[model samples]
Target: MISRRHLLATGAALGSAAGLAACGSGTPGQTADDAKKSEAGTPTVTIQFWMGKLTTGEDAWYKKIVKQFNEAQDAVKVELTQVPGDAWEQKLKAAQAAGKAPDMYIGVGNNVSVQVGNGELADMSDLLPAESWDDLTETAADLVTVDGKKYAYPMLFEPQTVLFYRKDMFTEAGLDPEAPPKSWAEVLEYGPKLKSKGRFGLMMGVTGADFGWQSWGWQRNVAGHLPISDDWATAKADDPAYEKLATFYRDLYSQEIVARQALGPANDSSAFGQNKAAMMVQGSWGISQILDEFDNLADKVGVAPLPTHDGTGTVPVTIGNMKWMIDGKSKNPQAAADFIKWAIAGDDPAVLLDYFKTTGYSKFPARTSVTEAVASAPDADTLNPWRKVIADVVMPAAALEPQYDWTVAEAFGKAMEKCMRGDDIPKTLGAVNTEIQGIIDKLKLAEKAPQ
Candidate 1:
């Protein structure tokens, strides 16, 4: 493992060492003369970046990472910037219109889908290694892949959502703490029991819905009912699978098993802390906060994978990731790709495993080696089991996280939101599916039209 001592030592530790320690050898992004002068002068190459808020003290960690890269390599210096969560999508649209979008970005699974189709993003395939990238997890590669061509360098591979339960409360309710429901029917059965105890059985997001995000067909991708076919065309949003999943989500709330909360207003974990609900369908990352911030209830909490519709327990959940694309218009494509490779190496399973263990989150490495290293991690006792699940349960499902440009998902989210709010299902689904078809056709991604 790379040590902090090695990272902090300066001078010889400064330039080439930084490259070797981090990105290794960079493909030259500039002529020798251009790079030579950069080393001697006040070096700068404003490569704009858009990424989510990293909790690790950004100033303490990220600023240092960027500075080291700039000093270590004459490649275009990264001009780090934040894309505020709420306004990220809006700002991206505005920037693209002005022809001044960031050179690199970290966005959600759906954003890539939209940008890729609009030709708003650059291809990252040429710069990355084609073979021997076995360190990357099977699913991590899928997050940024489309039609067999890779676009994004995977950043983090995580279970998009997980189920959380209370320990003390279960004991008081005379329920076995170790035994959580294994199927959706079990959850419904337990809901009434939880309610009898004056505890809210389940908590839903602001929409008070479940079916919107995770689904039977689209989310699981088992049916291959993509808005675009393998080539890129719209398929049916009203397919049997879609309707079955929608009913699954809606019935929970209507049956009083899931309750609505302030999820839309702010972060969802905060709602759980208020003690208004007993359980939440939350991201695996939340485990860290619950254990850290809510010390009073730390031991009282335990985690279990969500109950599935059937005993199979297969989840549609996936690892969320974004690719780092080089600016096609960049005069220094080589340099840009070099920086990107280092930046994305964060996905290398080894790197990810360290991050997940050290951070106390449920994230698994995007690479296989990192996942294997769990036995050696200081936090192995906690990390190992989750690592097994990520490698086997979660990683296998990750291949389904919409690798094709996400334009269809944009339509999917909008259509679902409307229907969740009681909009006409037939009209909304029809219109959204039509819009998705147009997007697929525009991108030349779908091969055959729906009959």
Candidate 2:
């Protein structure tokens, strides 16, 4: 599962820090002494790299890659540091203030937008080969590009929400295990039938904060636009579509289809694995957790795209991915770029293929070549049977996560929670409009909205 603490930090803390100007700090202490010539008289460049600790074997995979890169060359050396997720923002901020930030660091999902706005990321177009940029899928390219300048090298892509259902429970409830709900109305129709003693029909985020970011894709799916106007000048939460969307949540909560007390956070798969819920809406990363912690139920778990509002079109999903970026103020940007190229965008697909394998195929590759390599792997189907559904149905329907301030999303989330608690829908949404308008005006967001 994706780290909730890490995501929370990115949305809350980093979002608040995006307005600061880029610091003109000197290189870190470690790189200061590494400018000396090596034994052969060739100059050696030392660059620091930082990444967050992950529950997946990604930390070990990154370490192994760093070791291999260090041993295979002498022109450049990478010093790696693994920071805890919750501490990442604070540590990085401290380093930036001291002019000791790492030359390269991993970029969290939508946090890249904030970083780009702060001018903290360097353009990779000049550092890497043109083919490296061309290798990215169109969607991946669009995600890393802002104002036509590429800023990041994406590593992986994951759809934010997918439906995971228990086949055994469906069978016991006299429902067809082969056919799951394809629409929100069908989900409500199916929920009561699937519920039994000590179990809920569905599990999802019911609180305000959780609802804020988690429901991003759902908002687009239902309302056809986000809470803000296209020009980012006005609030659009008062749209009638939102009232329809709010009513759906109210029905789900009032009917007790979803428990008032959640079994766990929406990201956690333990509740589903232990049979507390027959159906769950979670990210693709949860598949890895299920295979690792509940291997016995792997066969019984089924994956599909989240249901749509009217069941007539593709359900929009939020795409979340990690990327590697160079610090704009780094003294050794070329060295850092070379390392990223060798590890992820190199001609040889072996390194990236191994990452997907090590992560149990839970994440999808960003490059077309890597995707092709993965499809042709020796044991592709045996590793994960749901890969086809995710790669085809879910991924093709995904939209990039919104890059606006988290505060805007929080206002809508609070409104959603109030609606679920049986508050006046018109009054709740009017408050959302006022709150978001204040944010837009205070931040001067209209002037900064993407052209």
Candidate 3:
């Protein structure tokens, strides 16, 4: 769910906390040889941790955590490295090839299969205590497991997209502001009414169609995490759900219910923010952006679960943004795993809380306890309302991102673009299906399936 906005520096939303409050501590004995008292009698282990690119706010906040981590524990010192998010894959590949990977890294969920497929990560089942592992949201927890062996520590998660709407627009349109559209049918029904007010009713992302795919995939009741077949050898592009989605977009476009700007180069949420659109489905990150850029309209904005087909239920499409993993070749695997567990869900809620708050409540901590702690904070009500939507609705419905190669997702995006432009849905999907299945075949996906 790292969007273009997250990468670009907006003025710092939440600055780093001055200091961290002690909340809890991990069991002492599990430290193992990850650190030992030097001849100087000081116990210290240098944890080499690499994180993807960060916004100014994220960088400042993370450095504070590293500072606090060093101050709070005498046994572990994290040597933080910031890698450009775009270059992470190439950097990781080169490092692995050169036999000098870092101890741990922050990476995307989609890269899990590739990393595990290439033997880049270490088994973490023993390092992250079972109880600690259990505390993670099940969907996030599922992403790190390969072949039934846990390979990464779940960190931040966000629903790939959520329903963001202007309550004022609904009220202006004589609709219930408290009750947003609950289904695609409702969206179609309300869209024109809102459009009459000189606003586009719906705004779907057309940039890469990732948001569109997520929304459609959920409605079709496709398992959110895995868009392809269970065996990872076929793309289910031809499923009936895709056609319905394409048709929906076409109808919205034809009726002028969807913003024309959304079909252009503008960011998906831009139309909504500019008051030209009543609603758009975007990542939780969009909520903060709106609040920061348009403070006066902050109270008018609201978030709801991504609408389902008939408002009956929703399939989880919450995606793992970034996860922490230990390198298989690390000399300090234990220290690396311990660092992730401690920094994320360990006994301290303050550090994790600081992390999320600093991101302006964009990152959803994967650990249930941390999530609840943030939800109940003193200023919880003061933050964006979407935090509640994320906690109450999105997390509960979160589905695992379908396991497939990144290329498959890109291909699906291209197919969706073609469908939106009036191409035959079935034909486009069929071609996409063949293209993706061909990828699976050429890559020997069956052989790569987690064993």
TM-scores of all predicted structures: 0.74, 0.85, 0.75
Residue 201 lDDT (model 1): 75
lDDT of 3 by residue, 1-451 (tens): 1111221122211110101122332223323232234223354457788887655667766776677656554555688888876688799789889998888888766567677777788888886667778888776777787767888877787677778888998998899999988887898899999885656887776544454345534534543334467677667777766777667767776777876545432223555777877887777767656755665887888788887765777646646577888888887677666556556746556657876776678668878888887777877656655676677767777765656567777777777767776788889889988988888888877677654
Ranking of all predicted structures according to TM-score, beginning with the best and ending with the worst: 2, 3, 1
lDDT of 3 at 351: 53
Error of 2 at 108 (Å): 2.2
lDDT of 2 by residue, 62-155 (tens): 8888887776555567899999877988999899888888999998775666678887888887777788888899888978888788898998
Q: Write model 1 residue lDDT over 1-451, tens digit each, in one string.
A: 3332332242222223112223222223333444454556644355676765543433234555566566655534678876656787788778777877777666555545545656766676765545325456676665565656666666555565666777666776677888877676777776656663334777655341334344423345433454445545545666554554455545665666665433332224655666656777676566555644565775666666666666464566655554466543444444455565554353344533544555464555555666666546766656333445445664455434555555566567666656655566667767777777777667666542212
**Prediction 1 global C-alpha lDDT:** 0.55
lDDT, residue 387, model 3: 75
Q: Which scores better on lDDT, 2 or 3?
A: 2
